[model samples]
Target: MNSLKHHILSGLFMWVLSMQAQQRPNILWINADDLGLELGCYGNLDLKTPNIDRLAKQGVLYKRAYATAPICSASRSSMITGMYPTSVNSQDHRTINMTPLPDGIEPITTYFRRAGYFCSNGNSHNMSRGGKGDFNFLAENIFDGTDWRQRKEGQPFFAQVQIHEPHRDFVKDKEHPISADKVTLPACYPNHPLLRADWAMYLESVQACDKQVGIILDRLEKDGLAENTIVFFFGDNGRPHLRDKQFLYEGGLQVPLIVRYPDHFKSKVIEKELVSLIDVSATSLELVEIKLPNYLQGNIFLGKKASKREFVYGFRDRAGDAVENMRSICNGRYKLIWNRTPDRPWMQLSSYKKAQYPAFSLYNVLYKKGELAAPFNQFMVATKPEIELFDLKKDPLEFNNLADSKKYQKIKEQLFQEISTQMVAFEKNRIPEGEKTIEKAKASSLKYYVEKIKTHNPLFTADTTDEELLKDWENRLLKK
Candidate 1:
């Protein structure tokens, strides 16, 4: 009688484990490159994004979502680690072979993998992307394949699909390209024909990305995974434009975030609380009843009992060879920026950026002729103040500087202290590397990349005779 009872208890324990495994929902994260909050659902009427709008209608849309870092690889690194980039020493804009993530830190996907989720880091539609990870640290065995089709039978999944659109070198498609005349220009940009054309091309790229999102959603439905999968759509960073992509201003960090899971979340709701991209991993784990580790800094924002965030932080460091260091703190209405290297010009030399946009080239002409207008000319100043304070509620474009205002002293002091405390906790050092070290890092990166490319293409040979080609390659490596 005792043996029979013990056997029955063992069977019941296995049955409970199977039920828990079946209850976990699949997670799908779609991250777009350099896309700002310009979607139709985000109050930008000039752009056409029907698919994303429908997703918003069926999900929760966040109005105040931001990336911890504004650049590509840095932001992605922070996101995957669920911590601030500065904390992990990954805030530099360009990283070569690998970044030294902190000893205890690991990619958030590793935890999901241990929990029996079949993870992937590519499109669900099986699109080819040349297999470029582009992340700061190594990613091995974290992602099983490019799509969910490679997952074991009856296993839950966590997939990420990255859409490269609205970034610099915008796509120009034949299918109803955006009209230059109809595009609405930002107040900080000059209204030139060339600038308008650039804006139109960016909007066109957004449309193409929207269509791609539709394809991914359709694929989920066809695969019968929509009901059990939670979909998150957001931009990896901000828009690729002057004073946007690489800067600490609103355009540089603010991104559109939408989360959809019909079974456990409310539909057609708009959240106005501050949310950071770092919260994504924690939120996903919460959906499956997993407790976030104590080391994670992000809070869960998807569940019914979500709490509001008091402040969101942003960091910038060593963008290309420019050697910039800055930090910012925002409370959704006011923003405070501390420019560590105030003497450095905002428009530092970046071959990667200057080649794509008319900011530097045309700004020189406009400044010489005194044709540049307000807000547009502000960014062209040779030097900036050590500190900048802006009431975002009033100056959405971040035009007027209120750091020196006596009336706002209390507010400014509060934010400054908060940011300083956080920075100390993270052990963030704002000192730029020495000139020799910066040059060494650049040369080492160039050698590694040149050799890696040659390894992939055995027939290719470096042109020793062409000085321009070597220079261009070095510049690209610096911009990598």
Candidate 2:
């Protein structure tokens, strides 16, 4: 009888062990900035990105994935909070780093830690660059390039790493052609060599980021954590160029979202389902059995058949704030952009409108002289038709603004209602004014970006000696 009992208990134990092993899978989230669907898996052969491509092959690729906001601060804020920018009231456009991660919101890291997982991250972007909020990475601004293996041991761990190599700084190369000759132009932008070269440089930055991603994945396999981890790769927002980063167009708000889970999720799949970065926090929480909070607006994208968000919304606010700056609202298929300050230079607002692009400068001179007036000049002049709408199918580049057209009234009406509803919600739940109201709030928000925007007086002049305000500005920016 004792021998028989022992046999039964041993068999039962084995069965329970199998069940537990099948249930818990480690999670690793790798977020890159401005990287679009130009991967080998996404079908761009100009660059060689094997590791990330491997993850896409093994997991699922969400082709129509999007960021909640076009700019860095707002988009990242949406990701950390699991709520739309307006819902959080942090959608002031670019002041994300102006405040600490909002209070009462549980960051993904904190949630994972509560659920018995260790977390760490690596990112090189200026912490002030984004609204670096309350997601609990162990240390800020300190993740070395590719040393993810040195994190704590004994328990299953989750690591979220960020790579910014593909941002703006480095984008010049050859053979891996990202230049003008092979450039695809959005009708909003003029197709010229300078624009093409500019686009190529940005693409190169993305490819360089891929090389780093490959190295990190190799570390995972080499360290024996390959089978136990889940890998998710995505961009922070759209590309960093003019219309891409600050606008509500497809190129600016839509990002490539890919996920690779070990054996639990293995297959080449494309999910037409729309998922927002905001949902990432909730999804991570659900994976670890932590209760997803009620305050969060994001739902888990668990490949489960019952996810509830029909359309994703995006936000844009206070880009430069001089004039022509505005806010936007996007539902996966259609987007509405509102220009509150319309007198600003439209084309000059773009980061790519450099003097290096002789044609651009020539056009700018003509525009100022009242000679050139197309959509480009109209855009630079902060021209507004109240609501700008686009159908993603016909114009993936989002160049043609269809708000004033006779046919798209239904589209405009539908989006207007959605944007109004979400904005009301955002104002209610966001943080307090915190010892400041209007003017002070603006200063607080503009602490980091103000120097560049406010340059006409004592600085921004060519005669001034070299200044160290960059460092001082960075430090002040971080404190707020």
Candidate 3:
């Protein structure tokens, strides 16, 4: 009779554990590559993103969401680990040698899996090959499978769906093509016909990405998981454009963020608080009733007890062959950028920029001809200011420079001190990769770009100056 009682008690305990697992909300992260605040929900009426707009209406929309890093690998590394990329020596884009994460620190998936959550990562369109995990740290056993459907019966899940759209090689939406005439170009960029057409193509790609989001949401509802799933849709970084993807400017750092959880988070709420992409990690763990690890730098920005950040920081390290070290701090109203390597030109010799960005050639040609405008021309200079201060409230496009202005000296100094303090803290726990590794990476990147340029642009010659080559490309683009 004692043995029978033991068996019955064990069965009841197992049943209780199963019920707890089922009660936990399934987390779904839809990460869009190189997308920005151009969605219909973000007040860009020129773009048609019906699905994303509907998602915003169903939940909360963040207006001032920013990524920790402008580049993918660094940004994603922070997002996954809930730690600053600088702290983990993951600041550089595509590090030569990936390092294992710190002893106590692990990917968020590890925590989810420990709590009986089935973790899956896969491309939104294809589930066979898995999704983009461009993390600088070595990640093994991060996910149990490529799709959540493979999980056991009644098991909760943490799934990431990578949507690679609107990055580059912009895929035109044949079904609904956007007109160049209707698009509004940024004042920083030259208002040329070719640029307008390019912008339209980018919008088309964004529209296509919206369709993909709709498909995923529809599937969730069709499978009866939408009601219980917590959905997060956001970009990995800023939009893929000249001076946008690799820089610390708002064009690169700012991204669209939308969250939906039925009966948990309030619907139709527009959150204007400064939120970092890394916060998603902490928020997800909190919503699932998991204790946030002490080492996590991300703040919980969702529940009733959500905290708002006073300042959002961004970092930019070496991107491909071009080496740079820049840091930015924004306190909603003002922003400060500290450039470590001020000697390097803003338009450095980056092969990816030369080939992928048509505007690169156009800018070079226009600058050489003395046709580029004031603030735009500033970027073409051989050297940049070591410090740049901008009043974001007065200058949304970041055209004015107030670093040297005596009136703003107090504000600038305060920001400088805050950033300095933060950097010192980050440096305390940083893992250095040594100078030799960085040099090797620089050499490899340079070699790759040289070979690519020669193979593709036959007109490009060793003797051809930048101005000459750019002029030729510009003429061809205009003609088209």
Candidate 4:
């Protein structure tokens, strides 16, 4: 009888465990566009992000999280697929249309969907354009719908909510406006009123983003899903500033990451693991007990089989209206940037970047007036070294390039060899060419997009079109 009782108890325990697995928690991914680790929780006292701060306090905050690429579509594409943008031929800042993913590779959402999880690109309200998770690949088959509301009853969900706040055209908050005088400026930028105002406006947008985060959390609680939901928050790329956006600097590549894994993880813990945004897919898969596919290059940094990465890689390709190539590798303390197009100037003309970009325009004015200083003028440098290295510990701003230093030559060669090996492993082109071909493609793509817009709205002619309008059209076209 005792033996029978033992068997029954064991069966009951197995049944309980099976039920827990069946009730697999929902995954909520919140990504902020063009944002860095500038929140209150990240020790930035300038911005008021109490809601995000609270979330960080209740979760695991990563201090050294980096994005695979620094531009929007490239970074997001790399992020969603767990593949480098260059490897998938999506390294460009924006594509003419929704470029399909490379052969035999599918979005990470496909795996979630296959595992009986309803995959969505927004919240659970069926709101369109709910979040701007702009990846270069098409999303028609990836997202079952805009939100998890379309899912069958009793099914779990994996949802991504993108916050477009703190991007360009920073909307001000009159109720609690962040004063320009109180805002702290990056030493690289000038202490001009316009620059300060730009910084203040960005802080206000951050506040707005925090409020949105609070709303999402409240909605989860209202729906009685908070206890069983794993919420992940991170930035899609870096800050929206000129040097911080498309460049491979610390300000461009590093982003904030917070994860609240329901009851599984300890609260208020700071995780200092060297993590890449591409790792998000692998981490989520492990958390959900799904086997990761072989094609994914990202390492899992959570759950029972977590592993730490020694170095994080970054890539930069063609930006809007310009063709360029740059690659970077960072091993937490030191960083190396390889500029394939060293002859090109930093301030290449991009209709999208120049329009509605306050910092870029202001910097251009400063450059013309010969008022730009030190690191601020670095953005306008006509020629850069083919390879640049920095000891991030000593030069936080990355102003001094130690690539040419005799003492650091050994370190520079090591990083160069390491990065080069990685590039070969990923099948990345060490030397990019055909600048004229790329520019032609951009012009053809833009012309085709303008024609399409004109078809719908007859008033959107070449003469009548404004730079802002063109920028929006380009964005829409790139997303297809």
Best model per lDDT: 3
Worst 10 residues of 4 by lDDT: 471-480
Off by over 4 Å in 2: 1-23, 93-103, 124-150, 173-179, 185-188, 269-271, 305-308, 320-331, 340-363, 369-373, 430-480
lDDT of 2 by residue, 29-62 (tens): 7888766676677777666677778778888788
* TM-score-better candidate, 1 vs 4: 1
Estimate the overall C-alpha local distance difference test score of candidate 2.
0.61
**For model 4, what is the alpha-carbon lDDT of residue 122?**
75
Quote the lDDT for 469 in model 3: 53
**Candidate 4 lDDT, 34-147, residue by residue in tens:** 888789998889878988998888889999999988888888888788888876667776555445666788888888877778888873223565556667665567777776
Top TM-score model: 3
- The TM-scores, one per candidate, come to 0.87, 0.75, 0.93, 0.85
Off by over 4 Å in 1: 1-19, 97-99, 123-132, 428-434, 440-480
Per-residue lDDT, model 4, residue 87, is 68
For model 1 the TM-score comes to 0.87
Q: After superposition, how far is residue 190 of candidate 2 from its true place, in Å?
A: 1.4
Q: Which has the better lDDT: candidate 1, or candidate 2?
A: 1
Report the C-alpha lDDT of model 3 over 174-252, residue by residue, as the tens digit. 9998888889887767788868877888899999999999988998999899999999999999998887899999999
